[model samples]
Target chain A: MFIQLVVSGLLLGCIYSLISMGLSLIWGVMGIVNFAHGAFVMLAMYAAYYGDQLLRIDPLLFTPVAILLLFFLGVLVYQIIIQYVVDGPYVSRLLATFGLGFFLINMAQFLWSPNFRTIKESMVHGVWKIGSVMIELPKLASSLGSILVAALVFLFIRKTRTGQAIQAISADKMGAALMGINLKRIAAFSFGLGIACAGAAGSLLATFYYIFPDVASLFGLIALVAVALGGFGSVEGAFLGALILGLVETLGGYYVDPNWKYALMFLIYLGIVLIRPQGLLGRGKV
Target chain B: MMELVRHRRFPTFILLFGLFIALVFPWVVRDRFAQNTAIFVLMYGLMAQAWNIMGGYTGLISVGQVAYFGIGAYTSAFLYTHFGINPWIALLIGGLITALFGVIAGYPVSKLRGRYFSIATIAMAEVMRISFSNWEYVGAARGIQLPIEKESLLTFQFHSSRLPYYYIILFLFIVVNLVVYVLERSRTGFYFRAIRDNEEAAAGLGINRSFYKLLSIGISAFFTALAGSFLTQFSLYVEPDYVFASSISITVAMVAVLGGIGSLGGPILGALVLIPLSEYTRAWLGKQGQGLDLMLYGALIIVFCILEPKGLMGLWKRISTKKRTSP
Candidate 1:
């Protein structure tokens, strides 16, 4: 039972890591917490659901399509709204994205009717039992896919030139500009890429989780906590932080009470943040 | 003479005029919808004013103020339901308890800076919400519902009319505003601004940073709890979700921000504008469950944030300055 719980927790954590990594990327590069991130995730879920229902496309195949769609949406959001407030005070940035989030959520409700949806005939289904442990196929597939995507993202940031350019910009904006990097272009790309990660995760989530306009609030908030837990702006930290949250949530739910899992996560987050405001692997003053 | 009249006498005249209008508003309006809107304005205005002290003046940027609000609601509900205590007294105890919780929460939380502080506040509220949802003592997710009593000042319920509720909230709003008005010019107020503007500089000048922050949050919590207690008595219900939801905190923050954070009359102005608009929109267009009102509200917030970060007060300042410099 413990092993099954651990395995499921790990699987859940991997998906959470995927979600937080997107948030972390945006925060690391732009110093803005995108409040609309969850809204963006909601969009991806709908996209996957509709793509399956309308076009007969499987969610697995639609993952890349969702990513592409969100990438453009991210870039458009930057050009239209975020860029204007990028240089403003923290309050303005926070309110701008918060408002965007509010707008997106309500607009979604208006258009989509606030109904809970699911991909009924997805490619992944059933369960596999491995030596007294049962693992759901969809969960296993999504986790593996998340791991692969995370690895790709890690490599993209570390090895590629554009990725290194993103690094330079995050490290020192003026320095990166002086180094002849196109600051505007890179920033927009980074924003798009960050949201694209949400797209991937959202599609994966739609397979097993119920989809609704407000579902963004659930995953979005949890992702925010995971990012903070790992230390803001640190991709690796967010990954680990999400894993810890997943394990704690599952184990806490099993051991204590399922209702108390979210509370436990929040308490752990508060304790860690109070003791080390910079997070588990973050640096400098909070 | 003209400058003095414009700067000082005009404001005093406006104040007296506004006061007279407010005093006679319920009697003159006589519409239940309008009265409800007025009550909401006053209630939100008071709560936002409380938020302004910690978030606007002190620059703590908490998004979990609903924690204090929920605490106040539950405290008053518990006292009234279980002990058969007068709600007026319960209001006081709720305020005191919520203030204590604020200080306790602030001790560790106030150490963090900027976004970290904001997220921690969120976590703090989330913990409260989740815990309250599961704890059977407080009725768990079902929440505690206040039994309806005879309408009176002591009971804090106004069954016959919404007038008493309006007057009570109005008085609370005025008192809170006056407190903020005095706090704005006081020595502690200066410390709050200094810490907000530059904590390092404030510390350099020998100011105890965390103490003032804690004080601000404590005072803010007290007043916020009063509003919460008022809500319980007014609505005759206390639920974990409604009271502890992050939306309450956001709305309160929006009120302060929209009206002009750190300003005396800003929250009142924000509430005056926002509450009526929201109520009217919800009444008119929200019947179909389409969130048109919220969508517009969100768009307005984005536009305001992008175009005028300092909010309506900033716009007022710009207009006044432009007029002064035009000649």
Candidate 2:
């Protein structure tokens, strides 16, 4: 039971880490916390849902399409709305995104109402027995897939030229611009990339969790906690932090009352914030 | 004489005029729905004023005033239900308890700056909500119903009449504004202003950042709790969802922001504009479909943030500047 639970949590953590990486990247590079992040994820989830349920496309196959669509949306938003306020106070940026978040959420509510919907994908529901322990095969596979994708992203950022430019911008935008990097292109791409990652994570989540208008708020809060715990900008930190949170949540739910699970997560977040402030494995200033 | 009337007497006259309007509002309307709406507006105005002290004046931007509100609501409701305490007396006890919790939450989270502090408040509110939802004594998610009794000033019970509640909330609103006015003129308000402008510089100047932050939190929490207690009496029911909703916190913050944060009159302006506008939108569109008000509300916030970051006060400033130059 312990092994199974741990394994499940580890997989869940990978999903969190994947979703949070984009947020961390955007925050780290752009110095803008995208309050619309969860909204983006929600939009992507709906896109994936439509693809699978209406178009009869496999969720895995629809991931790339959703990613592309969300990337364009990100690009449009950055160019049209975000760029104008890039020079404003942090609160302005916060409000702009917060407004966007509200708009997206209410738009979803207006369109879909408060009804909960899910795409029934049989691929993620299969179970496999390993020794005496039975594990959900689809969840395990999805977890591994997410981990693989995260690794690929990490490697791409490390090796690719555009990735190097992104890193340079992340380090210092003006410095990168002086070094002949196109700041605007890089920023637009980075926002798009962030949304793309959220798109992938949304599909993965839709496989397990039910989709609703307010689902993003819960995931967004979790992502914020994960990002905060993982050190605002570090990919590896997000991975570790998500894993830790997942384990804590799973164990707390299993042992303590399930209702107290959120309380436990919040307590852990508060404790870390009080003690570390920077997070474990985080080298950057919070 | 004209200049004096414009500058000095105008403000006093406006204050008196506003008070008169508030006093006669219930009598003028006489309709239950409009009176009820006025009571709600006053209640929101009080809540928004309390939120402004923390978010606008202090620049703390707490998204969890709902926690204090919830605590106050539950405290009074619980006392009245279990111990049969007078609702008026229970309001005081509720405010005190909620103020204590505010201190506890404020101390640790106030150490964090900017987004982290806001997120911490959000987390705290969520925790409170979940805790209230699960706890059985206060009726859990099903909510607690106030015992209906004969209309009494002490009991805070009214028999299908909003007149008493309107006056009560309006009184609270006036008291809150007076407190804000007093605070704004005090040294503590200056300290908060300094802290909001620059914490490091304030600390460098030998100011205790934590102490002032906690002080702001306490003041804000006290009024917020008071508003919450009043709400329990006005609504005649208490629930986690109703009191502790994140939207309540957001709306309060929005009012402060829209009216021009860090200003004495901003929340009142915000309440005056947003509450009535939102109510009208809901009344008009809610019959057609749900969420139309929210959609418009979200759009307005976006437009306001993008175009008028300084809020309506900024617009006022611009018009005044133009008038000055036109001569």
Model 2: interface root-mean-square deviation in Å = 1.6
Q: Each predicted complex: what DockQ?
A: 0.77, 0.56
Predicted structure with the largest lDDT when compared to the true one: 1
Candidate 2: segments with Cα more than 4 A from true spot: A282-286, B1-16, B325-327
Misplaced by over 4 Å in model 1 are B1-13
Indicate the DockQ of the complex predicted as candidate 2.
0.56
In terms of lDDT, the poorest run of 10 residues in model 1 chain B is B4-13
Report the Cα lDDT for residue A169, model 1: 89
Model 1: per-residue lDDT, tens digit, B37-67? 8888888999999999998899999878899
Predicted structure with the largest TM-score when compared to the true one: 1
Tell me how far the alpha carbon of residue A168 in candidate 1 is from the true structure, in angstroms, after superposition.
1.5
Q: Any idea what lDDT model 2 has?
A: 0.80
TM-score of chain A of each: 0.97, 0.95
Candidate 2 clash figure, as a count: 0
